[model samples]
Target chain A: MRTKNQKIRDFVLSAISVIVLIALWCAVSTSKPDFFPTPMATIERLVKLFEKPIMKVSIWGHIFASLKRVLFAIGASIIIGVGLGLIMGWNKKVRAAIYPIIMTLRPIPPIAWIPLIILLFGVGEFPKVLLVFIGSVFPILLNTISAVSMVDDMYLKVGKVYKANTWQTLHHIVFPASMPTILAGIKIAISSGWMVVVAAEMLASKSGLGFLITRGRDSYDVALIMVAMILIGIVGAALSIVFSFIERRLCGWMSS
Target chain B: MASKDIKVQVNHLTKKFGDLLVLDDISFNINKGEFVCIVGPTGCGKTTFLNLLTRLIEPTSGEILIDGKPADPHVHNISFVFQEPSAFPWLTAQQNIEYGLKIKKKSSEEIKSQVDKIIGLLGLEKFRNAYPHEMSVSMEQRVVIGRAFALNPDLLLMDEPYGQMDIKMRYYLEDEVIRLWKATGSTVLFITHNLEEAVYLAERVLILSNKPAKIKAEKKVDLPRPRSVSDDKFVEIRKDITDMIKWW
Candidate 1:
């Protein structure tokens, strides 16, 4: 719907916003250079961080270590959450049985489970992944449940009038109908998963952005800590942008 | 009485919501290929009656037979156009039209041919790939109508399908339904509270009394196709149905 000129104008406006943000950061850090670390110093440290291996892994290595865990945890949670949510929402008896369990565990923060998780699963990749899963799965599952409930009774009646079997109704009517809401939940899960993964990595492990921040704290390298912070934000934003693109494509009927 | 020519039989049909009686001992017969309108006053359980016929809900008593057997959605090729916009929003116009066939496990070739015929019939070629949000309100309803008729159903139940449309759009859609009806020769039971709409479309008008509603009258419409509201006979039949409704 937009003309080429309008698109260019919008892009320029957003670019201006990012430049303003960096300029503000530079001004704020000039007063307390040692404590805050200047933007240029952080950028220099980031480039150097890529050159040398901190804890025997490059910047890419640390990034990938965190990325792999978040990806695995979120992917597994989405599958498990959607399946459970669909069944619980569709069948009243199942919902009644599972309702208390979700309510009981959902309030407890993901970080609080570290001790029990470590004891049960041991200190390894699985525990970190499990922590992220605990943090993200509730949002995904709750959203999916709401999504199932959101499907209009009128649409289901139409399916019934056509004599669609239970499987057909679930496949054609329920799943597609609920996708917009489910996608909303996944967005929340991704953000929450990042928060949990970083905390888990900081507490234990020798690699990842969180571990880098821990090492910076020990060595008092403000620039190194700032670099890790910037990377976490950039990657989190990039992941969000990617999923936002997917949501536009998947639920075009709603947004369009 | 049950007969080969009759496509639908309602036998002592009754419905209740807890202690409240909604429909009391109603019975009717619709001949094959008939376009029958069940007209009633507002809040007179018109929808509940249609729902019972479609078996969306069980009757407190009585049974409805389609082709000499108890009505079953699986056994009968049935379709519906309800007051609500019933087209699946996720599907494009063409996919929505082909939905019933897909569920019935009709081959892809058969589904395509059937959907193509409906697309042409409803003049939706321009919007075959368009989603519901991209269409005008009337256009969306047309897709719903097209979807229902694409089934080439044995019985089509319409519950005030044009209730939300403006007068102009309603007339346009009514004619389209008639055209589809004639082309397919499927039996239709259309429910509406509007006497003019009933007379405009039905071959026979079945009047319902106000709540604890029962069928009070059935008048043959006998007027020719594409009947106008300005015509004397058309007005007379509408008045006759109106008078029956008023007397109750």
Candidate 2:
């Protein structure tokens, strides 16, 4: 079919573009060998990193540590954020009371809260998770609020005409209508969560991808830092791919 | 017509937005299992009338009575199919059809049987498992209509359900709607700007004036079932309604 052929062509085009980017990186690195690590050298270092341990954990161990923190934070944020967002969207009184406070807190960068968070929770997993939670929760909450408010009034009328109760209307109509936008917010939240977790780990942590990079910087191991950086990019991309797959499955109707 | 019981009675239904009245002292009675089409000029508050009937909006002064009591969606089984396709995109065709039954807390077996029957009736069996995005526009509207009819509502309200479709699809869906209406024996009040569609579908066509929409005229179409638009009688009825709807 034409679509299949077009998909294959698209794949090939994207592969070629990536290859060109790598070739450009190779050329630039060759010209400044002392400062920049070549793509080959970085790949070699990445493979070598698996054999050894950084801060008493291997590369996979560090990835797991970061993953554990980010996933926990994102999970908690989703539960709290979605619940609060839906309630706020449905109830004008609640929205009037809480939205102003949320708006005030949302603009401050998660990193700016490091000192206060550290002072309260210490340099433990709790503080790092909280930092990521702060970074991710607002976008998810705000997006959910907007999505809930923007659900077509026509759909609500359908619910009403069916004699659907308030609970049924929210469950059946409002929730699904808001899903695509909420999924988009989750995508954004994941990336922001990743960034915040790295910054938190780099500031005060012993075993994470972020700490691996910071440790490399402290010890002047540029190749090790590059390895950690590349791994972080790959992991972030993989997470995004997972979210996109879920979004496609859940929100297939929007695309059509 | 004299023997048929009145299913819906609108008594002095008036709606005003601030100083501007949209509907003025509208009173009508729809007979049990009757198919009635309302036609009016563009922006003549035709939808406002339907909305007030469904209580999507409250009337300034009026009452919509069903079965000798004030109409309440909670107390009555009412379904509405909007002009635009209102199928829930997240649900498959089968699930969309089952939505009302599920909301009413019907048993799983009941839901399945009802959904299966409606899907078959709508000719959506081929696309029952397909999501809204996977189907064509007309097919999506079929799903929407199927969802409404599956509830076997006491009253079914449609607001120009085929206004967006081409002539071919419109004719096909119009027939499908007629089939569904006859099979279910539900009282239907369909609103449209298309006079031919009104004449084709309704047993009686209600014509409304410009702003502050009131019933200007009501024409009875005594044509037999499966009526033809090309028939001389159909054209004459369509022409009569068209002339009544003209503002200038």
Candidate 3:
């Protein structure tokens, strides 16, 4: 009962906060017309963006391009990272051999690998996707390794007493026990992958939301830049909402 | 006892954790289809004793035999209920009960029938689909107990499975365990610190000394089924065991 009331209060508070933010933006824009674009001007620019191509494509086309790169990168990262992580976590020999390399690579920012990735794959779709993959894979892999390695010994003992083979134990016990942590890792990976894709596009892409921002800056169209920024924010927020919903569904056991 | 009737035999079982000795030269025998409870003082290495018997921890020196052969989990069907709640959080009550049978590669139809029987016997029909986190502590323990009994294991080892529950719930689950044991006819080795629980549940109660635990006394209770705590024999047996292990 209390939670229902709290939920309503939380929703009302969030809505009021957004309204206040937009009102502040509008007030600031009125005072400095040339420097800051008003909320109306940004919304108008966003609508006009759909009518005409900003960089050889419509707004949705740019969004789809960015979305495609991020989704592919994240998908590949989850598959490869989770597989390698489980192996590394389960086997001492593999963990000793591979964990050092991962630790050394993980600290370096993904943007720092942009030049090398471009040289290796060329300035096409591969480089952008690779950068996003590099950005996302480490977090997912590290979290999976920890999750699998730190599984409660009690659960393993349960498996042992049940006469479960190693494969059965892994599939039935370890995998399910680590799922909540793995889902958390996936959430982190998606946002990180999204950010890397934008940075990669800003540096080299001919079409994408990042490219739209760059084009707007080159033309000194502040409203257009604001529009792109707003779209990026909205898309990022939407992705997060989708991931949270998935987490709640899949890991409901963790919470309740 | 006849060799064929001895389901479990622990010969000079000892366990040492590095420099620290936990179980000291413990030897016991459990007959086929017997309900035995091991009672000791708090932290008297009861869990270590169960773990050694279940082969979760290797014995420093000794042998655990089941049916005249070395006890191997791979060859024998052994189920354990830990002191803590051991239900899988991801699975519902019914699914947890099916876990052991599934591991044994039983047919799907057989698994369903066994699960249905255990769930019904445990009176978990209403909370059949509830996950571990969604259920109360007693219910979670019931799921764990149901999971262990579903396999009809050769030996069922329980380590204070109801230590965290209230007296009412503990007595209720203890009765349920007795019902399951009678119905399934599996050999049971239950370890707990509660003397009343031992007298109430076991045909034979093994008492242990504190620390480096060794069997101090063994009392046989020939009382009839559904013995009450207030009964003369039950109270006498509970008092005798309680006095045997009295530290304070």
Best by DockQ: 3
Can you rank all candidates by TM-score, best first?
A: 1, 3, 2
Question: Per-prediction TM-score, please?
Answer: 0.95, 0.91, 0.94
Clashes of 3: 0
**What does candidate 2's lDDT look like per residue over B151-178, in tens digits?**
8887899988898999999999999999
Clashing pairs in 2: none
* Worst 10 contiguous positions by lDDT, candidate 3 chain B: B239-248
Segments in model 3 whose C-alpha atoms lie over 4 Å from true places: A1-9, A31-35, B17-21, B246-248
Local accuracy of candidate 1 as per-residue lDDT tens digits, B1-248: 34899999999999999989999999999999999998888899988887887788999999999999999987999898988788889999999999998999999988999899889889999899899988887898899988888888999999888999999999999999999999888999999888899999999989889899999989999999889998999989888777777765
For every candidate, give the share of true A-B contacts it also has.
0.79, 0.84, 0.84
- TM-score of chain B taken alone, every candidate: 0.97, 0.96, 0.96
Please identify model 1 stretches exceeding 4 Å from their true place: A1-24
Candidate DockQ values, in order, are 0.72, 0.67, 0.75
- TM-score of candidate 2 relative to the true fold: 0.91
